[model samples]
Target chain A: MERKNFLRTFALVAATGPMIIDGCKKDSATKSTTSTTGTTTSTTTSASSGCVVTPTETEGPYPYVGGEATNPLNRVDVTDGQTGVPLSITFLVVNTNDNCNVVSDARVDIWHCNKDGYYSGYANQPGLLGSKSYVGETWLRGYELSDSNGAAKFTTIYPGWYGGRATHIHIEVYVNSVMKKTSQVTFLETISDVVHVSTLYAAHGVNPVRNASDSVFGDSATDLANEIMTLVGSVSAGYAGTYTIGLAL
Target chain B: MYKAKIKLVYKQVIDASSETSFEKAIIHASYQEFLLKSQAYNAEGKFKTFSRMKANDGRANSLHYKLSFSVLHFIEQLDNKIPVIKDNLGNKLSFDTAAFELIESHIEDSSLHKVAINYQTETLTLIDFMGDYLLLTSADAKSNEPSETFVVKMQPGLSIMNYQEINQFAINNLQLETP
Candidate 1:
């Protein structure tokens, strides 16, 4: 998808977060379908302008540590029995050096917290539900090598919010055993409002930290524009998100 | 918002099974777990380990006769130009040559088989083959231990690539045992 499309989608969601929350306070029961349909474009456009190198974001305290060496969980379904809003995340890795051509065989490592904001493979994760340590647990963590189309897809649930950071999924791309990119894919609060306030995710309430309040994504407009995932689908049926990442390698 | 700065603290590791050798059997089991779950081989391809022996060093039967050489040889082959361990602050631990050489030589000279990890001090553990040798205590102690046995039976006609089966077949059928 084009970068402009993602930016437009982000802007729409940026406005919808407050609207959805305010409506909920007044019991308006506004349908999210009206806003969701606005961002769904019919035409597919070239992403040549989106070819600029993806901004380097923090690897966050919970990286796999060994890149692809230690992580053996190569599966697409990283849910690992945890329940939440299903998210199908697709990362299109392109080369900034080579006219934005797709780069195949790049190793992509992904990890995020569950609906309760608990990350696996950590000893301590304190949050709203409770303080629990998931040391050695590999749920919501896996690695996938990019295919012929430079696409590495993962089947995971929509990650919940943590204390300081926004709702985001951590991503690291390695080409030829070298880390080409380390960044994150953030979700729009409009979508988070629908998913977080649902029956499954209602306990956590609404994630107060939107993209603008996030430590990593809050840095700049271009940061969210470059890192925000373009999500399609809904709160009830689940969402499929596509993000284009440009690597200099 | 402030970044949640979490440093690495060493977790306890223990032997998971008595019957299974830590080297091949356990590694293969984990490799199979990856293959079965992912349905795709690693980008580096199938799990493999290589060992080399010098003529006078082994004398054919010694248990620990310079494993450091082979370990260092593998380390030198890594094409990674940068450190893999990256935290929020971007301070990293690179697996450069000099550090491994020092650690290997120190271990060999001191005649110590195991290294102690201080839980109090934050340390970023380097990605060594040793991580595969032991299961972590709390999280993996239950499932990863082979003695506690859970079966992952392959479904009939599942389109998994036959490379692993073919390799196993070669090992079992084509071997000439020396009496």
Candidate 2:
């Protein structure tokens, strides 16, 4: 009887060992983004405590890197003298696998579209809004460094939605000038649907996409709720929101 | 995003059976969600920061990759294998170095991946990126003969492509480093 019991135990271990090993291999792919700092490459890394690196995303074509108004790393205000409702964004950078510790001194870059769904510096580009171009135009893109406590802030307008995608802002995190992660952050659709859409955003048309429907958001559905910014102000005076983004370095 | 699957044929040894378990290995690739390529990204910039976005159903190469990974990720294809490269300059580097120069430097969307790899040499002879997830096995690794060929099977969303169009489209966009 003892020998039979031992054989049964052995069978269970043998049956489950390979699966356990296989599960270890995929842990990184599901937990972290570990690719090089390419424009759209995603490798994998492991994270235990902090949030996994935001999934890497395409660096959309219009990352205008022209001049000062375009580079807003030092100051809190990033409006660049453009016309739109007032909005402010903040980012908190942290390291992963280390109890979500704040990663100080890292550089963060942010860029988004103006209220009309057009990006700056691309002239006469056709869009849902018609064929007007901001060629040589530079607004709504810049870089900033995380403070000693891992905080970076930008003053700008709420991003307007285009036809194909939900509202989003792109960001890149860097340590020692090495690109560590690239991802898009989004607002609650209710905020865009009722506030930004109803007020200054009305003429462009309603933001028809929702979180469940957007592909990018759907791809990372489990993390979407955590990545969204929490807001406080009204559309009349302009909305303000704060976000805590944990980056696994 | 559309739904699709890719297949990979491999050779696996069945120790308990004492024979080839199957003539070839079987694998499939599937995604939980896919994003259609965005139209807002087509405008030309003085300097390009990202690549073109093709709708999820339209990216042929990425589809091929999903199929490839469904197989390669499960098999023992690259362990301790060395691929041969004969360069005029006679340069030798570690696999990490070679992988960095060859795939890491050229492709964007750098994410540090967790993969099980064990190699004897520093040479990145085992793997290289063709397009997205489609990994190219070094032609020299399988003795003098090339390994089994990989093919991408089109699903419901893709229309058939002519020979010329296949040659015209890039497998993956390579970022040219500026001085």
Candidate 3:
């Protein structure tokens, strides 16, 4: 499925509160999604042009895009039933048109492949996910609604690689149900290398493709990096980082 | 007009014999529920109905989609006339729904409406029947082929993919809800 074809107009019905993006405390999470009725309307304010909201990439194939349910730990931790080193991901939702200040009430849904390069809730997947699909499994996926400072914190393992894309997490930030932006975040090549070579992701044949080799990242290296997270931890004791998403809306 | 969201409801016909595929029925019903909830259609393929079934005004209600259905034989007998859950493409997975159970079921007696089923072990939510699209297809003789065949109705002409991930997500967390 082309990234451009993944629709972004579904409702974001995750947890939301108010918090600072940079000062996201441990265990803080803000989940987001849109309402079903809102899907018919284009909530994304971006055109393929120079819209300041984060680049609108394809929604990928395995997003729980339309789900309104929240896991008990979806807010702060998504590694409930999976195995891997720990990772704490934090995101800050901001209105780019409004001087890039924090925007509260913004929802963010993040999903990535399990340590084995597989995604939950999918079947007959390509690469290592195998021919047998594992639909409805919500491991390594969660929701976070930014607090007053526009911050959402999630706890899970670092992402594994797939056939085409590098190690990355699919992030969608929405203002209520209207998706203000859809983009992705990745670790630095070296950092991801440590992740791919780890016991959790190595034996399963994680994608060997680097960021530069990834078709999407290669075409939009600078754009994708604009939203790359700033990390401050090791791949062993678990890593923690924060990302600020700029949306025109 | 806001299209009514297809609400999926599954009443636990806890059979002591557990002879048939009651558990599988929930999972199967869930797959069909996801299809109806995720993909909707009209003859023109351009129109939509947003007015989905409303369960209650609870924190749980707005967080997840609807899930409702009966045992497999009963559903199959409906002949797809009603919007029951199914794989759509006939891609029955090799995984078993009996491996799962509604470990945590929050029973809200305020009304026989709000229903939340969760896997007792994990943080995943199975089926949240907070009353959306309760009566999707009436038991009428309306002879419009089941919505599953309405592939052309997909706006982008995209096919509703398999339910492996969504189904597995719930199944992995499923447990046999003991009576």
Candidate 4:
């Protein structure tokens, strides 16, 4: 009976050991953020090869704040029935502090302007769409948790360009409920050039500011390379874009 | 005037039922509370201090309190002056600033009342100013103890693109402008 009891105890420990370790890991990650200095860059000290800390950019005036309390939509397709060219945007999040390993279960949020360059959940978006209030509308804004592979994808339309900015998408990476990075990724000029002239986007015309002239992206080559996404598709069949974000979490 | 409010609370299970392992006595104490100040300044060019209040439910197991000023006042404190730089080659480079940070002690004695007994912290945040609001990862550390700081990001009622826009919008919202 003693042996049986010992075996039962051993089984319980084996079953809960991993879960306890995970809880500790999450707790440590949380502690690091509170003690972190002002920089929004990665707080960890490890330098993994090929992992560049994604440049921190402004979430602008239109990121969906308030998390679950706001929209409460955990979806993969942020199109929200808006008509435009279909695009599959993929992000691979790796931890520079963890040997560039994929960060599974990280929350990734993607938001951008519709084809006419109007963002949802705002009343002051000025563009071809005029001054429209999408105040209650949550189109083109949603979040998905990364899978075991540290990747999240969104089925979004080709984003439209707004004044004072190039065609780009805003992304936020949250690991263990802490926002590690808030950045924007721009499409290659070659890709934006084609999508802007397509049927739905034609009304807005091509974006005047290219990647090299963008306020956030044009600053340096490293910025552009870190934030630029690669697209492989056409306006007719839609495009698939991929970007890897490195965080010093 | 407080424009934005952010609160982070940490809970601890002080006592639990041994039979059921159910939490019986729990402490839901606030780790931090940040209130953004709106007044221009006082006689000493200082902002009003954050109001502190504590409350307890019928259980009497938790402590709730408010402390610290909002990090947004950093915008009003800005001189709004753009610095011009000239390189050795006699070329002028225009500088445009977009973001600002207010670094301060994340843990105060009042904030540690029930959450910690003896706390020693060296961590801080360069709180990022996002136009009309502020975004930061709230953190604190305790020597030789397991500590956790929840991520806290906030947006005021209005959000804008740049500092100019934030200034104009804040002024209008606060009615600081004179006719």
Better of 3 and 4 by TM-score: 3
Clashing pairs in 4: A34-B139, A34-B140, A38-B126, A42-A248, B35-B70
Checking candidate 1 for backbone clashes, the offending pairs are: none
Q: What fraction of native interface contacts is shared by candidate 1?
A: 0.00
Predicted model with the maximum TM-score: 1
Which regions of candidate 2 fall more than 4 Å away from where they truly are? Answer: A1-75, B1-179
How well is each residue in A12-61 modelled by candidate 3, as lDDT tens digits? 21112122222343332323333445334322333333232222344432
Give lDDT tens digits, candidate 1, residues A1-249: 353465467669878766654443433222232223445533322233332222223333222223233333667888989899899988898999999999999988888889988886454568986788664356788788999999999999999878888889988777875656668888778888889998888999788888886889988988788888899998889999999889997
User: What's the residue-level lDDT of A69 in candidate 3?
Assistant: 35
- Tell me each candidate's TM-score: 0.47, 0.42, 0.46, 0.45
Evaluate every candidate with DockQ and list the scores: 0.01, 0.02, 0.03, 0.02
Error of 3 at A67 (Å): 18
lDDT of 4 by residue, A13-79 (tens): 8798667544444322321122435566434321233232223244332112221222234678989
The TM-score of chain B in candidate 4 is 0.16
lDDT against the true structure, per candidate, is 0.52, 0.48, 0.48, 0.53
What local lDDT score does residue B135 receive in model 1, on the 0 to 100 scale?
13
For DockQ, candidate 1 versus 3, the one ahead is 3
What share of the reference contacts survives in each candidate? 0.00, 0.00, 0.00, 0.00
Candidate 4 docking DockQ: 0.02
lDDT of 2 by residue, B18-83 (tens): 222111121101110011111122222221112223332234333222222222212222221222
